[model samples]
Target: MIGATGFIGLNVVDALQARGVSVRATWRKKSITVFAQKRNPEWCLAELDDTVALEEAMRGCDVVFFAGGHYPRYSLDRRASIERGRADVRAVCTAAMHADVPRVVYTSSIGTLDGSVAGPVNADDRTVDPPRESVYRATKWAMEEEVDFALARGLDVVTVLPGACLGPWDVRLGTTGVLVALLNGALPWWVDGIVNVADVRDVAAVHVAAAEVAPRGARYAFGGVTTTMRALFEDLARRWGVRFPPEELDVAAAYIRADVEEAAAAPRRGRVPMPRELVDLVAWGRRVDSSRAALELGVVARDRETTLEDARQWLERMGHVPRRAEATAVRSRNSAESTRGASAHAGSRKR
Candidate 1:
């Protein structure tokens, strides 16, 4: 596994490990120490920018799983974000082809596909044309082109387009992290939008199965339930017994566009607005299909209930919810209040 320490990558590593596979994971040079602490002891150091090191990491590997792609944060400068993504695709593909890895499972995203599909069962959907949502989508599609070139050269490769992956082992990054934050009461209100989502473990399972069973040139969609922003947050809140802001802010796209532009002008500490050209993203909605993935790769998604329950369990385990602690604090406060009232009454009688 190339990116064994990332949000999705960590889940992939854990799933693979549980199945008795010893992962020879790799991370960027600077990430080696932190990744090493959490990953298998056999983890290797490879800089994505260093072609030679990347090639060495792929050596002797039967299948190379490229989960190393980074999604640009909303804060990145536009041009630099595009360049970084292009560089990643160039570097990783160049190294993999050179190392002659028999098969490479490249993790792309549902963003690369047209979001106009009617629902999650639209198995006939194809790729979208130019002028997309985010720089991340553009770069991911660009990487897909590299994989196409590799396929033309008779290299065995399969690509997976995963929807928003959410589950445990999240280091609190990615889109899933945003959901986590909302569940933890950080987000003020539900941003009105719809997204297809799947558990990280389910996505990882598809990747591993694709690596083992999928044929060359197969592209699979790894999406689970289709949901609106409102529905997802509501479900999560109910599961966790937490209260979320149900009040949807009535901001139109024009309002957001103007504000985002103003914000972009000032460029805060590490935050960047979505590209002004792509501000229509929140208004865009579509379902994805993973039937192909199911039929071909035998990937079965845990039902929506299971996924939500698992997410709640994960939050509890991570101490994101101090349920018992909150209860104890409330009891302590009540006790103190009772004692104060009794003492005040006794003093009044003495007076």
Candidate 2:
């Protein structure tokens, strides 16, 4: 499994290990010892561009999980991101083909599919004609194109397009960063939008299942639930008992705020306070369907409420939430629940 140290990739490794499958996981220069200590999978130190090393990693392996790709944050290096995205897929597919690997499971993003349509997005959905202007989206689209090219060259490949993934092992806090930012008080208001969300654990399970049972040249779009931004924050507020900001910003206001934040933070931090990509993402309000995955690959999603609770618990346990804040939140939640229970009992007696 390439990108074994990544958020999704590490979970994939864990899922494979849980099934008692021997996995040969890869790492770059900076090693992730947690992957070694916990899973004990054979580790390969290989860069994405190193075709020779990738070939070595693929040797003797019947299946390869190519979960490595560039998803830049804060900074927009369009040229470099596109180049690396294309190169990673090319190198992995080429190495897998040369190694005569029977199955290659590539992790793509839902961003490659069109989200502007009025209904739930599926694997067959295509991006808008001429494509939208976003470096990250373009990079993912390019990677998908690379997959198609590899398929034409007689390589058997399956693609898994996961939605905004949350849950544990988000060491980098990539997709879950919004929650962190809200908890940390960095974000003062919510953007009015909707997003398809999936737990990383579920996503990883789908990837492993796809590798095992999915038909070659198949593509699966999987996410747990579709929720509005307000609904998500409201859920968190209910669970945490915190008075989160109630203001909702329109897309225009959000873009303007992002621009202002970027201008102010760039000089000091060399990173934008909020990337334009994020603004565009929050402005995206599309539902996604993963029923095909469920019916075909047996991919099942945990309930959304349960998934959020797990995420909150993980964040608290990982020290991402301060002790004092957590205590306050707990007390507030208990008080609110107690009051609601009392009201319901009283109403029942009156009735």
Candidate 3:
């Protein structure tokens, strides 16, 4: 398991162990892998640049999980980000070929896909050009292109595209940061756009299945529940006893703001409520067609409310946010529903 220290990587690790499979997880030099080390008994120090070390680590392994790739903190440097992203995937794919691993499951983003989202989109949606406006999209497109080259050279590899992921063990916050910021009263307002997400557990399940039996050069897109950010934030506010932020920022304005916010947050890696990637995703994100994964990989879509509730409880358990009363939240949500109904009735009577 490569990228065992990351959010998706950790959950994939848990899934691998659950299947009674022995795992040899890799870690970068700077990461504190103690927590991962505790759960994953075997660990190897392998950096992305160290092809020799990666080959040695993959030696005698049945499958390799490539979840560790270049994730840009800001969408500022297009050239650097694209080059680095391609290089990382190239290194991993080349190493897998050298080590003669049977298959590699690479974690990619659903953001790289493009098509008419009037209904749903699949692998047929990929475009010849990256959305030039967002560097995040470009970098992922470049990475996937590298995987295509590797496949042509006879390296066994499958790709899994995951949208926004929310769950526990996201110590670095990742996509879950947007949720944490809202619940902790950091994000005062939000932009109205589509958000496609799934529990990290479900996404990891797809990874395991893909590695075990997926056809070489196959790609599975995993997206569970879709919602508008406004609706999600309203539900969270009502449940958590916080006032709803009614202001919906304009999408174009939001893009500029996030760029500035990321520039400022770069020094501290501080948790800013909005990031460029989040803006880019929601603005351009489309509903995914997961029929292929569902039919072939046993992917199941969980409801949005259930997924969010689990994520919130986990965040509280980890002390990332203060624990709130479930019963109280339920009661408050019920009361709000009653109030809205009554107001609607009153308006009808007046009309």
The candidate that achieves the highest TM-score relative to the unseen native structure: 3
Candidate 2 residues lying further than 4 Å off, grouped into runs, are 128-130, 259-275, 323-326, 329-351
Higher-lDDT candidate among 1 and 3?
3
**TM-score for every candidate vs. truth?**
0.81, 0.86, 0.90
lDDT of 3 by residue, 1-351 (tens): 888988898898898889898889888888768668768448888999999999999999999999999988787789999999999999999999999999989999888998445678775579888778889989999999999999999998899998889986786788888778877667855688887887899899999999877898999988778777877788888766666765678889888888888788888867677788888888885788788889998878777777788888888888877677754676678799999999999999999
Candidate no. 2 TM-score: 0.86
Each model's Cα RMSD: 5.0, 7.0, 6.4
lDDT accuracy of residue 13 in candidate 2: 86
Compute the lDDT of residue 291 as modeled in candidate 1.
87
Expressed as tens digits, the lDDT of each residue in 104-217 for candidate 1 is: 888887766666556453433666453354556666666777777878977788888887777776653455455455555665444466667788889998889999999888
Q: Model 3, 100: alpha-carbon shift in Å?
A: 0.4
Give the TM-score ranking, best first.
Answer: 3, 2, 1
Candidate 3: stretches off by over 4 Å: 115-118, 325-351
The CA lDDT of each predicted structure is 0.69, 0.79, 0.85
lDDT of 3 at 174: 84
> In every candidate, how many clashes are there?
2, 0, 0
